[model samples]
Target: MSDRLRVPSSVSAARTGAPFIPRVLSIAGSDPSGGAGIQADLKSISANGGFGMAALTALTAQNTQGVRDVHVPPVSFLRAQLEALAVDIQIDAVKIGMLANEDVIVEVGRWLAEVRPEVVVIDPVMVATSGDRLLDPAAEDALRRLLPLAHLVTPNLRELAVLTGREIGEEWDAALDAAEQLSLDLGTAVLVKGGHLAGAHTPDALVDAARALRQEFPGSRIDTTHTHGTGCSLSSALATRRASGEDWPTAVASARAWLRESLEAADELQVGSGSGPVHHFAGLWARGSVMTRPQAEQLASDWWEIIRPIRDGIDELPFIRALADGTLAHAPFVFYLAQDALYLREYARVLAEAARIAPTSEEQAFWAGSAQGAIAGELELHASWLTPAQGITAETFAAAQAPATTAYLDHLRATAFDGDYAVLIAALLPCFWLYSDLGERLHAGAFGEYARDPEHPYASWLATYADPAFAESTQQAIAFVAQAAASASPEMRERMLRAFTAASQHELAFFAAPLTVAL
Candidate 1:
């Protein structure tokens, strides 16, 4: 299966010949409220399309409100979960979030000896989203042991400051400098999430790649109390993307988008009396804007530029093509849609949030109505797809999918959080527009032979893609995203452009022509 079809799911109970799935083992503390720590890590990994497993070092009493009590697990017990998962399941990825003390950190680090997963995304969980220190002083030293081995070490501004003992001093350039210094010191891919610091946009930098991506994402600056799990969410998201095979930079981008959306959407939900949490499934219910035909049509014409490499060789890409054509044989798609429905349920609310912070009510209404329509349509679509004789339970879908390609989502997250509105729109376009185009093209043409000569269950699937309105909406979305991305500096514009290009490639792979290496 193509990475585009990837979903993050770890083998919970090991069995022989288990179908391949992205596995992420999280070593961290547990959050009973499911907002931060290991709980947050598991949710983030699973939500971002990975199989999440956990070995908790501590359990904390907390909610959207705050952490009240913490019970540290004996370090030996922490090591056992690590050993058990490592021994049985093939862990594709590992995430370290919220280790309470140095001993526990060292224990997990030592346990790392046996498993040795390919990708390790360390969140460097030093501080909570509420600005409380979660790791003990000793853990910092243990963290150093894994830095050299980590694929990526994500640190927010404060963590960077604490780790490097350098004042990043509110300047974007300074933060980048600090991140670079940390990378040099640790010899690991370092991501400095500048979300908490001051700036018109939250710019994050990935310092390992030869060409560093110092990006600033522009989005609605949400003023909600539910940001308790942002850090855990972001790191887990990055880990999920990384395990799915994206390079570190792309994974960072993916993590950023997922986290930003969660935060942006949190503005609408009322999870607690103090500060509500961001709704994880907001996208399922919300349709902030209608993707139109012009946008879809233009993409249909231009998509070849991005996807022809993958599409013409379509036969080799049976599973992904199915995703594109909505003709995949798996029953999981129904559950996948159910997951998406839960997500879309809040999509409009998030869009409403975007409008609430938007400069105009017109944009607000557009988003609000879009969310309403999206909710209704999404619910119906999921119901129809799931209500059939399909054995598409949520868990079943979780089990069947493979890992995904995330460069596109990363592009969007970078822009959505730091770029202007136009950039956000541009980043989001491929997801909406390209999928529609791919589905339409295949329905009308390729990937249809799988169905018996008499009928095509893939019928309406293609229509959703071919609709001119869907294409048109894509154009407007492009305009919206591009217009907002008009930056003052050439560098800024170039960065945004790079983000767009990278995202375009991410879209292309979904419909990549199946490559035949036949001799």
Candidate 2:
């Protein structure tokens, strides 16, 4: 959501030398069920931000229950489809799935060898989720020969076992070993998926056959039966992300995360009776138009209204009242400032971590500069009271940090380290937003005795938050978070809101803690 990360408008894309869109080609069969094969592939590609194109290999008269019939296209026509697309369009990536026969596989593989698209993801779909054979057994050898052509091949446990000529045990170790073997033999990266394994986690590993680079992506298994097109979706999403300029590991991680969200939201769609398809546009649906304005523009206003009760409660707290009236004792205020200084030290590190993982350079710079600003600007205000005139140090600033302070900082640290980037930004937002809101209100002398007075002791402190520069920074943070929420999946947008609301509640606790301390 950085200024640099702003997506070019479609007009801008057309004017620029860069591609107007990442064009993904799904070279797979048709799924009448709309839950697998090319249907699902196109959905996955579009959901992950790409332009999707498909060349049908075959047609299946199937539903959620199972495949009823199949008709393979003539090999000559199949080659025509591939050639037509290769010659006419710019293909950024290709996802190959469910070739019905050896002739089909050889034809597509020949096109692949000829064109050599920059990114190729082959799903190796041998069997359907309904226990129907998709690829002809005679084509298995042809598929094996085709493996080396792909940049990455995604095979579920059953497919992995077949490809490697090994029995897949229930333990995930078997899949990992088989993936390593397959990668080395084929000279391509292999993503060994363990979604079928009876476990609490859906753990997957990406193994580079030639390089021996292995990265494990661990995610809690989403308890849903509507995972019909998971493999097709994963491979297509991976290809799309790669086409959009993500590294192998990052692309895989992002694809998996998006697929899981789609899985969780799959039940909402009434596409079929058995396992339904994942809702590709769940993000767009959940973030419906907010009045007449765009979702991102409405974010700050929406969140403020959503947490109105919490804000009301905070305004009613004794600590806030006393501070506004200048009736708060000097000792508790000093104690609060010391704990704040301690909190800022840790807060700065979390911001730095955010900067490290930000997808865009502008976002990275914004977060990095914010970290420095926190320590050099806000902490400096606290240091004026806590430190000696000479300088500040750990010994001088250290105090018995309040439990509220510890809890809030721990939540942010956890988000910074483990949560999604959008969620982390949401967690960091309340500190900027709520403080700015309260400071602006106090500066207006709203329910405050000495805020408007020139001689008020904490006037300078309140002024820092109300400063125009600080308000501008807070607005930028809000805009970034809102833009992210607008684009994120429904589940992720909810997570962002939860993080925001939880942090807002903690802000209330942070202020109240000083009132309870014995002066």
Which one wins on TM-score? 2
Candidate 1, 217-286: lDDT as tens digits: 4444556667777777788888777766666656776777777777878867766666565565565346
Q: What is the clash count for each candidate, in the order shown? A: 73, 0
Model 1 RMSD in Å is 24.9
lDDT of each: 0.62, 0.85
Task: Give me the displacement of residue 124 in model 2, in angstroms.
Answer: 0.5
Off by over 4 Å in 2: 1-20, 130-133, 288-519
Provide C-alpha RMSD values for all models, in order: 24.9, 13.3
